[model samples]
Target: MNTRSTSRFSRAALPLGIAAVMTLSACGGGSSSGESSGSDTDTSAFSINLDDCEDPASATEPITDTFDIGYSAPLSGPVAGAVELATAGYDARLAAANEAGGIDGVMIEVNYKDDAFAPDKAKANGTEFIQNDGVDALATFGTGALSAMVDDQNAACVPMLYPSSSTADFADIEAFPWTTTILPLATNEAKFLVNLIQERYPDGVSVGVAENPTASGKVQGDAFQEVAKEMDLPIDAVVSDGDPVAAATELKAEGVEVVYHGGVTGTCAAFDSARGRIGYEPELVLKPSNCVNAVEYIAAGNAADGIELGAFGKDPNASENEGDEGVAMYKEQMDAAGVPAEIQGNAVAVSGWTQADLVVNTLEQAAASEEGLTRLGVMMAARDQDYASPMLINGIKWYSTPELLTGIDGFRPIKWVAADEEFVPAGEIISIRP
Candidate 1:
């Protein structure tokens, strides 16, 4: 877990603020586990049938005639570049869908708000999208902001689809009924990192966590703590701060041999900065959100020779397999959009595209609902729906239930190879324990 950066984007304007506030006020809105051998009746043995669209056999009917989708993210924050990439994927998908004749001729409209990675701001914008703009669902990014608005969205019965938060608390389907995530939960990432440590350094592992004070950070940090205690591994130090350099220094003093970062790209930059100041560097483990776009981090002069990270989708930077439709589509759209090819594979864009697809699918389902297109109705339709978007990590499936919409069970580890300046796959997918 690493500290969150204090840097703010210079381009965000007051108009964006007013729009977010207005959106929130207007709608009045207000809005995994291991495989197990079990009996057929066992809950763990159940799986959704993706081929089942609806009871009326509307699968062949165009879904576009029915509804619209909307989203809000940090389009103007420190993470904007990544956000833009994700949105581009969404845009391309939307265009492709439209070109193919939208779901039943119901055109999907995507409205986005720039929360700038601020939780309070996201909450406000979320409320506006639900209440004022009349968006049937929301696709959001960042953990802190989504957590901030969970209560409102849940109470309002607005389906918050494909939020980018991977925190365990958010994965508790029973607690937050209206929200779902697209990536493997952060708790899983922590578990995978710990498992890797145990296998590689069986003697004794000195673990360090750099965490932010936000809800997501705390959940991931707690997971690491629990696993270390369970395994009886020596916990070097768990540091919480907004400053990465200072946290790194403290971890170094603690003789930390393995570091787990809970923050995003900025935290990686901080770790890089700290590495420069001190002579020592530890094996780094990053959260899914932090690991995407390693080239930029490396180019910034961060030595990522021994870094490993958990990933939720196919790494764009990784070598592509022949006829990989998702990767091919991503590259085509990114190039056409004039986005630099280097940043195509980053997690931010993949997340954005995945979330957008969720929105699109939810809207398609909602249109077929007999209850019409109200937020609650749309959410109900989305509940328990199953679909595999092109952007999910390989061999990972996206699912949702009435109580919990995101899958918590999947994640893979990736190790950064300095020679290629890319993250190479490390191991098979593993589960995150509760």
Candidate 2:
């Protein structure tokens, strides 16, 4: 069933560190499925009361056959180049899974759309997918757009699963139980960065963040600000987008030692190159995971050298993985699918593969559960997920709990090797310590 169509897709940072298990505010609200409608069962660790909102698709008929999943992303926008590579990785994994006989013999079907990264468009696409298409599960991109439509998703009682902006509101399980994130949450990234910096420069170090106006960027900068305050590291500057060169100049004048970055794609190379142009070599310069792409460095030129990015385990460049079994499977499948060599080996592409791993594993559990292929069943499997993701690095495993919703306990730090134009492990996995 090739049901592809057209369409679209807030996190505040939580307390710092992987050890800070969130005591969600939405705990014990009501029914996790629309089948029970208004039943307020406090038994499950995560739940959503259908009575709070309306969407008949929540009780979507049991899928004893093909399981339809809807996926949406910014297929037509400024970051479309990066988006394309990510999509390639996702599609490749789906192909391999389908070839392997799929979940419980039920093949997965995907309906696709290009949201252009806009909120209104994403909201419209989501409504169509949940209500009209009657898809059993959903996955999407665009943080601001998705955050605006949480009510619509939660009301339908469908599992809005997989990769997207890991916003604060989405992870508040008590409130949005149907939503599960695959990307690195800002809070986790903040904790890891702060810890790594402090661990390396014990005495102290002045830090600065290159900020942007996007929802993801705002939240990223906010998270860094929050963690820095808690750790007592003075921030030299919180420079916004539009003038990376001038921003670099300002940060240098402020005596900023690390030109760390926060924001979506393009921002990394921009700021890193800006510093390079003026020969302002801060002790260290790094980027958040979302911007971990070597091709983007073309604009940043030589400045991209020495830039490190926080990864959620998987490094896109296969060379860095060498003998990893999971990564080997990924490369074999991606190669068989004929995905472009460069695209198949990119960080964004592996992120897509990782998202597929989350969904495939969740579907397997749902098919075996008593609930069986229903929206709530998927949610249950995702909530209790305790497994390894094929694409992660440094033995990172995927897990979920009442405290951790994303299944990611820490961020794997990978650095760019400018000479080889690839990203490799720069240090040990800096875990989120209590």
Candidate 3:
């Protein structure tokens, strides 16, 4: 579900045919003053080399009245599930934003193409969105879909506002200045998870990691291992290749006291089911943020009861949260937008709504920046943000800087109670930054 929308409200605007261009003096993107963390007003933080940027003069000559957004992601493949759910959230947010009056009275439009999770197809789609469709910004769903095309986006100087993966690669604004992510950084999640375990079980618990074999999964799994080692925490076993049951059995045989499955929702669900089938209950089974789902885990099996999760936002689907501000906004907006009633019970769409809101907010901020509504201005505005809303837990602040690329530094710990079919807050929100 989503929140807040009207049917494209109109605002006063300037003459429409002038092309938007980037100048160091206009936006202060060429200077080097705000490299340090949390530089909220650092206009010079996002560097742009015109030569490296794709035909900014021709590709974006005479800015159009409508702000076009294009997405390249797997719409027809196995991995398309999450993207599809996120799309619903994105669409809901876009509709709501347009309803609330799009940036400067200019309407926002979005187009999506099926990349089937292929890097090559994703690259082609990204190029088409720029050279062909003249989209104001580009968005890609997964890491593989964006890997082959992000350089092109940066070369063209187009802002690829939040590519849904958290491999830490997007944090390198030096290489991909036009890219940013609303997703919690994999590195940050790993560090926080390790620290949480260490702080709770001071005597030390045997940790085992179930690493997902995919690129993004490997990145997250590797981060977990690295952080665990840095904290002098030893892993009892590591399993990457095996059936879910086999992996669970192996970890149990190792006498692992805790298991952290750094994978997507489905993988985490499988691991939980596998553990339960054999009655191999560890002290805790920590799953990454991606596993914050209502149906997936519970449907997998009742073993999901004790599964600990890292949450970047409040749970909209939890029944007890019916009166929460974010929850009400999501349910009402989604219902208003005619999204299925079932989606209100799933956190995936809520995650999508959060990401889309980030994009909407970024565009809104960029429109008001000193450089005006140029594409370069969008990147500059996005590079430094202090986003606060009822969408996140009360004390958690989602911000970004040239130095601190990770947007959400902390996550509130959550526990899934299959019996109640909801996520319960376990403890205080943990911030790894300090």
Shift of residue 168 alpha carbon in model 2, Å = 2.4
**What CA RMSD would you report for each candidate?**
10.7, 8.5, 5.5
Cα error of candidate 2 at position 211, Å: 1.1
lDDT of 2 at 211: 80
Candidates arranged by lDDT, highest first: 3, 2, 1
TM-scores, one per candidate: 0.76, 0.86, 0.87
User: How high is the lDDT of residue 420 in model 2?
Assistant: 73
Best by lDDT: 3
lDDT of 2 at 320: 63
lDDT per residue (tens digit) for residues 1-434 in model 2: 12344222111222223112222121111111101111122225554454444543344235655677777677778667777777788878877888888776677778877788887877887888877876777778757767756678887777788757856667888788788887777877887888778887998888888886678788888888898889887787888866878888888888888866886863457777788888888888767788877777766777777777677756645566678777778888899878877777677788877788777777776666655665656776677655666777655656566545655666767777777777777777655522
Model 2: how far residue 103 lies from native, Å? 1.7
Candidate 1 vs candidate 3: the lDDT winner is 3
In candidate 2, which residue ranges exceed 4 Å CA deviation?
Answer: 1-44, 53-57, 316-320
TM-score, candidate 2, is 0.86
> What lDDT score belongs to each candidate, Candidate 1 first?
0.58, 0.69, 0.71
Whole-model alpha-carbon lDDT for candidate 1: 0.58
